[model samples]
Target: MSDRKSSGGAFLIAAFAMIPLLPVASCVSEGHAGGAAAKATGTETTSQPTHATYSCGPRGTLTVDNFRTSVKLVDPEGESVDLPASPATQQSRYGETPYALVLDGKEALYMKSGKEPVTCNR
Candidate 1:
């Protein structure tokens, strides 16, 4: 009789141990579905033009494109090459425009071929 009781207790402990695992398994499955859905929807976008900036160590110089989102880099001898974004684009909120380059962290240097960057704050 005591042997039967011990066997029943063992079964009960095993059942309890498995109960917690069920939720964990379900959570992992649901997380995978969410990730797949995000990928299939193609809902991601970026605000920066493809020509924002391209930094290749201290050797490459990026030439701004018409759209400002794409860039072509000039090599040491002035050879040009296209550059794609290293990482996927990130979302920017309301006040999130890329500022122009700064020499002393206080200058904005975004300008066109015949234009100059200006500061006009009231």
Candidate 2:
């Protein structure tokens, strides 16, 4: 019984570790959806380098009135990147939409509607 419990505990720990990595993909993909291009700017050690970490996965895909955004990547350390808002893109969407951010050297990307990031659909 003890052995089984240990195995279950180990499995739980492993599963939790994977949770953070999931978001990395969303941040990168979101940039592509809006026609905003992003490349690796550089890398920094520690979580403080970027403001927040965003990644691509089920939680990263966000949909609004006529547009959707996905996160394709984000820094492993949970850093945030800022992209300048494009007037043309916002106009097409009907208002001033927040720009998607990919941080941690493109390891994560996040889709933002305003101040908060839009959650992924699934």
Candidate 3:
């Protein structure tokens, strides 16, 4: 009876240990889905229309697309914002909040709502 109790306790401990991993697994699966969707949306090509994706923790994902004449940004909520390509720094307002995205080489700095800029790499 003692041995059985010990085995059951060990099993419970193991199960408890695995609880934290569940959320991590779900996040990884969600990230995979996001990647697949981004690719399907033409964000992984190497042509005239270039694309880039950045992960911003709780702020969510940021996708940038550079067309021949214009630039497009997609926020975490799948909302699209348009901006011109003339300036290296692009600023826009989403809803009532203002945001800025600065592109330098293969990196981008995203800032909004008085929060520190989030850096994203290509």
Candidate 4:
């Protein structure tokens, strides 16, 4: 009967020891959704990066880096234009000329200040 009592005591101690870890285990299982809770509690969490590339017809290619929150366009002339993120487009201005990039379906549209829009495919 003493052995049974000792084992029961040990079990109770083990269960008590695990109580503090339950919150940590739950946080780990919540994944990114837990980040919202941390933020709500005034904790800071690092954001993940999202990078995407789009090929536009003859205009060139566009690369978006969500981490830096910037967009870069490469032209066939090997010139690169760094554009700022806009509400629904990436836009850049050089001298008096303005350029805009928009994505539709699997294609991208490149528009200059006054020229016709160029279509590019992925």
lDDT values, one for every candidate: 0.33, 0.33, 0.53, 0.46
Model 4 ranges off by over 4 Å: 1-68, 88-97
TM-score attained by model 1: 0.22
TM-score of each model, paired residue for residue? 0.22, 0.21, 0.42, 0.38
- Model 2 Cα lDDT, one tens digit per residue, 4-70: 8677556545533443443453445465544333222121222213233333364442222212122
Which digits, one per residue and each the tens of the lDDT, describe model 4 over residues 1-122? 99986775565455444434433544454466667656633421122124456675455665544322345666444556765544222121111136554443444455554344455565
Of models 1 and 3, which has the larger lDDT?
Answer: 3
RMSD of each: 23.9, 15.8, 17.5, 23.6
Candidate 3 lDDT, tens digit per residue, 27-59?
444465876646544632332237778776677
In candidate 4, position 103 carries an lDDT of: 42
Index of the highest-TM-score prediction? 3
TM-score of 3: 0.42
Candidate 4 yields a Cα-based lDDT of 0.46
Better-scoring candidate (lDDT), 2 or 4: 4
What value of lDDT does candidate 2 attain over all alpha carbons?
0.33
- Candidate 3's displacement at residue 111, Å, is 2.5
lDDT of 1 by residue, 1-122 (tens): 99986775565445334433432443454465787547634533333343344343344333433222334433333545443321112121111122222111121122122222222111
